[model samples]
Target chain A: MQLTGAQMVCECLIREGVDLLFGLPGGAILPLYQTLPEYPKLRHVLVRHEQNAGHAADGYARASGKVGVAVATSGPGATNLVTPLATAMMDSTPIVAVTGQVPRAAIGRDAFQETDTTGITMPITKHNYLVMDTKDIPRVMKEAFHIARTGRPGPALVDLPRDVLTETAEFDYPEHVNLPSYKPTLEGHGQMIKRAAQLIRESERPLLLLGHGALISGAFDEAREIAERAQIPVITTLLGIGAFPGDHVLSLGMPGMHGQAHNNWAIDRADLIIGVGMRFDDRVTGRLSAFAPNARVIHVDIDPAEVGKNVRVTVPIVGDAKRVLHALAMQVDKVSRPDWIAEIDALRDEHPLYPGGSGGLRPQRVIQEICEATDGRAIVVTGVGQHQMWAAQRYVFKEPDLWITSGGLGTMGFEVPAAMGAAFAQPNRPVWSIAGDGGFQMTMSELATIVEHNTPVKFAILNNGNLGLVRQLQDLFYGGGRVASGYTGNPDFVKLAEAYGIWARRVTEESEVRAAIEEAAAVDGPALIDFRVEPEENVYPHVPAGESVFETIESPAGREALAWLT
Target chain B: MVDVTLNTERVHTITALVNDKPGVLARIAGMFSRRGFNISSLAVGVSETPGLSRMTFVVEGDEWVVEQVVKQLYKLIDVVRVTNLSAESAVMREMALVKVRSNADTRAEIMQLVDIFRAAIVDVGKDAVIVEITGNEEKVAAMIKLLQPFGVRETMRTGRLAMTRGAASGARRERAHTGGSAPDAEVVP
Candidate 1:
């Protein structure tokens, strides 16, 4: 059937089962907005800013296991999508961002609202296309979705020229994409799997290092099966927070920067490290030369480039994490690991994991109370820095994919918009946006988007009056100078939320944390709570950036990093 | 834990067949640089097929890293086939034009070495002679070393291009123009 490019976009989205799109209409994308009323089943959420639209789409993708769609106009609108595109790329989140570009005739004449959206986004996206004709819309859309959702998934951009949107085209989406070069390995090689199986069999102190690939590949069951059968302790990278049940006895929670001392010691002592779906990022490896000094690594990831890129791999398996883990699990025999478990337990007892506390509100305690009050079922999304680490440490992710954070990009201001997107995508499930004072202020404009949609998301601002993570670093490394890291004239977040007509409260005492969280959880619409946590509190045991995890500092001279446990 | 190469600085020649699509080269180059792989040299051209292009790039890495590079190249939608020319039993070759400062005294010596290396002196200027050589990495390096004593003026090389030795049969519909050698000749299954 002949259709305008805008209509073809709607049809293609419907074909891909996309129900929601987050964006703001502008001069260039007006045609798409004009055609929106024709498709009643497609829901469009108008975000306050383009960056938030990108982040919201990222959140939706992570929560729904579907390609999230974000739309923007040309020029600045497209430029603003950069951060979220980079964020999605870093975390391997599948997002499709559509930008309205200048007309083909005026593309090179510096026309109004014109930008080289494809050029600027090429380095950041998995792939990008500048659509010059309406006839290619169906094919480009199909390719965009296929590229964004397959292999090592990341964001893809389709910059639609305004003229193309108005032009008529025959819409024929291909039944199958003929991308012979883009085939992702879905099965592992028998020889490689057998070698890995043997490595696992011979390993006495085996550690399964989980990463986001496990969650993305839906290999949580296989990861658990192998771990439980082999009696190996499972450690997680930052993004691997929910890949394995946090409450399981074999779970070591998380390792690397700001990880518990015992987890570091355990890694240092392990004889075998089976990295599944996780890249050995610097944050997870600490000092690469000293990381896992005694362990032989068996790395598995869908992205072949990641294998042996950072840490050396003894047995490399490049395939879908779920498939590879299943194959390896079949070849491995059950074995008890009493000695290794005892050693890990002994390490834990020697330097127990703890939480930081302060005289006023403690971020960790607030998050713990919130999680307890909610029974740990809510999908927890967090902005970067201190509060993110606190949330990661304090909350229990009972199943895979319940936790979301900007792992590789470390994006601030991601919490509010992302949580809004997650809540919108999974309306029946409870969702919470947790942010630090510095990060919450970064995208607090999203409150308008939340209030406008009446998105039922609980917002927790760990108001420390400073960028606590950076301040901690400055104090430790910059001779105690608080320049750049300390905040001045920080807004009253509760008042700001109320101005957006959202329910708001402020709690300065630790005793009020649980009550405030429970009350906010009880609300049917958007709600916010500002907990005034003490400034300058730091996340510990910090590995002091570029140092070995074995050299962690539990506390600074004048302060305790985790006083709660003490 | 076993570091095979005592020094990790090793170069690899990678050849790939990609769809003759716009931005395909940029995508491959961008991914290599973004991932911190140093591209020592790169060359591209239309292949024997109508819609396919051939690309060869030289990069520095250890064995495992080179293996990873080949695998990652497959991940690109536009790239249909990739081979690490260094790993397989294949003929590896490079082309270079070495301009050496050839005075009356050294001209005879340079010509003698060029003849011994099976190279052709393409151009002879007043003070320099440009010798075009095609061979494996070792032979080319040896010739360059021998010519350097004569004050090598400038040099340029097409990094490396490789093809499997022997005639591999390809299943292609006989087209009059192709003489039935239409590009599936290089396709690896």
Candidate 2:
């Protein structure tokens, strides 16, 4: 059937099984907007900003395991999406960003609303396409979705010229993409797999280091089974939170800076480290030479380039995480090591990580209370900084894929929109965003997006009146110095949330933390609870850069609490 | 490891089928340089089919290293095929013309060497002999090095041209047989 380019785009989106699209229309995308009414199944979310559209798509993709779709007009609109696109790229989120460009005739003429969207996004996207002919729209759209969701999933872009949107083409969606240049390794090499299993089997103390790739590849169950069968303690990167039930006896929780002391200790002592779906970023590994120094590392990742990019891998398995884990599980004998589990349990109990403080109405305490009250059923997303780390460290998630945050990019203002996306994807489930004062304001413009969409997301802002993470780093690393990390002058988050038509509450005293959380959870629409935490509070168990994970500094707060306990 | 130094004189060429994407040529050239292979000359052009480019590189390296280079090049996603025409039944030719400092005394002697090598003098100046020689990459290199002793002034060489033996056609024929469309020049936005 013959259809206009705009109609063809909508049809292609529907054919690709995309039910939701986050975008804001402009002059260059008017044709697409005009044809949107024809597709009733494909819902368009009007975000307050194009950046929020990208974040929303990222959230949707992360939650639903589908390619998140976002659309924008040319020029500034497309440029605004760059931040989110880069964020998604860093985190390996599957996303398809469609931008409307000026007609092909005026491509390089600097026409109004014209921009080099493709060129701007080249570095951050998996692949990109510019549609000059209406006939190419279907194929390009198919390819964009394929490229975005396949291999090491990341964002792909398709820039449509205005004229192409108005042009006519016969609609025929290709069933499969046939790009010889694009091949993603899915199966592990048999020799590599056998070698990895042998290494794991021979080790006396083994550690399974999980990363976001495990969650993205849906290998959480396989990972848990492997750990349980092998009796190996599991440690996670910040992004790997909730990959295995944190409350499990063998689960060591997040490792590295701001990670659980027990988790770090286990990683330091392990004889063999099976790192899955993780790139061993500097933040997670600290000093490379000392990271798992005694351990023979077996690294499994989908991206071949990432195998030896950071740390040397004794055995490298390049393939999909889920498939590799399943293969490993099948080949290894199921045996229970009661001694190893008990040892890990002992460490967990001895170095128990309590919520920041019980006597104070602290953000960390509130996050812990929420985790307890909800039984880890609620999906917790966090903005960047101290609250992000605290929530990651304190919450004992019992389910895989429950915690969401900007890990690789550490993007601020990610939680609220991402929470909204998560809530929308799983409507019956409660989704809460924990944000720090500084990170909250970065992308707080999306509160309007949340309110407009009625996503029913609950938000908890750790109102410490500063960029807590940076300030804490400055204080500890720079001789108690203060920098621009302090945000002394800030708006009242309660008032800001109220202005956005969200229910708001403020908790000041130590006694009000639990009640404030309860009140926020009870609200019908999106709710924001502003917890006025101690301005000087810092996340502890911090391993300074170039230091071993075992060499951690206990925060002053931790020392004070311990002294009081004594 | 078996160490074999392969030094052969023939009309030989190497044909590489690479993804017609950006930066591919530079990657291929960098690979050659990194492997310590001295490239005599190189040429790259769009294949008869679209989305594939044909690159011809003439280089000298240890046989083992050259084999390893072929394997490593195959690892690059953009590289579709690599053909070493040194041993296969093929037509290998290189065009080179050298300008030597040919005064009345040495001109005849330089001409005699060119005749012995079946090389032709394309241009001549007051004090130079421009010899045109078409054969293999080694022949061109040997002629250049040999002429160097005669005070050769300037030299230029067309890398290599190769055709398979009998009716076995090249990449163009393969693409045609596969019934694929020609590669597109326009970049995907």
Provide the RMSD of all predictions against the true structure, rounded to 1 decimal: 5.9, 7.8
lDDT tens digits, residue span A1-566, model 2: 99999999999999889999999999988899989888999898888889888988998888888889999999999999998898998899999998999988999999998888877786677767788889999998988898888878899988999889998989998988877656677877677788778988788888999998898899988998898888888898888888898888777788887788887777767788898999888788877777776777888887755665566567877778999999999877676767766777777776666445444556667777888767888988887888998898888888887788898888899887788777777888788888888877877888887888778888888888888888877777676578788786899888888898889988888677778777877788899988888887778777777777556765565544433222
Off by over 4 Å in 1: A557-566, B1-8, B87-159, B168-189
TM-score of chain B of 2: 0.60
- After superposition, the stretches of candidate 2 with alpha carbons farther than 4 Å from their true spots are A342-346, A349-360, A557-566, B1-17, B21-43, B47-50, B54-189
User: Which number leads on lDDT?
Assistant: 1
Tens-digit per-residue lDDT, A1-566, candidate 1: 99999999999999988999999888888899899999998999999899999999999999999999999999999999999999999999999999998888988899998988888898888888998889999888998999999888999999998889999978898888766657676676677788789988989999999999999999999999999998989998889988899989998878888777788888889999999889888788887888888998888888766766677777777778999998888888999988889988998887765566547677878889988887878899999999998888778888777788998999999998899889988899889888888888888888888988899989988988888888877777676778887788898888788888989999989888888988998898999998888775788777767778656876553234423222
Candidate 1, true inter-chain contacts retained: 0.22
TM-score of chain B of each: 0.77, 0.60
Instruction: Give one digit per residue, the lDDT tens place, for model 2 in B31-139.
Output: 5665565776687778878888877766566444444455445535467766766455777777887888888998888888889899888877788768889887788
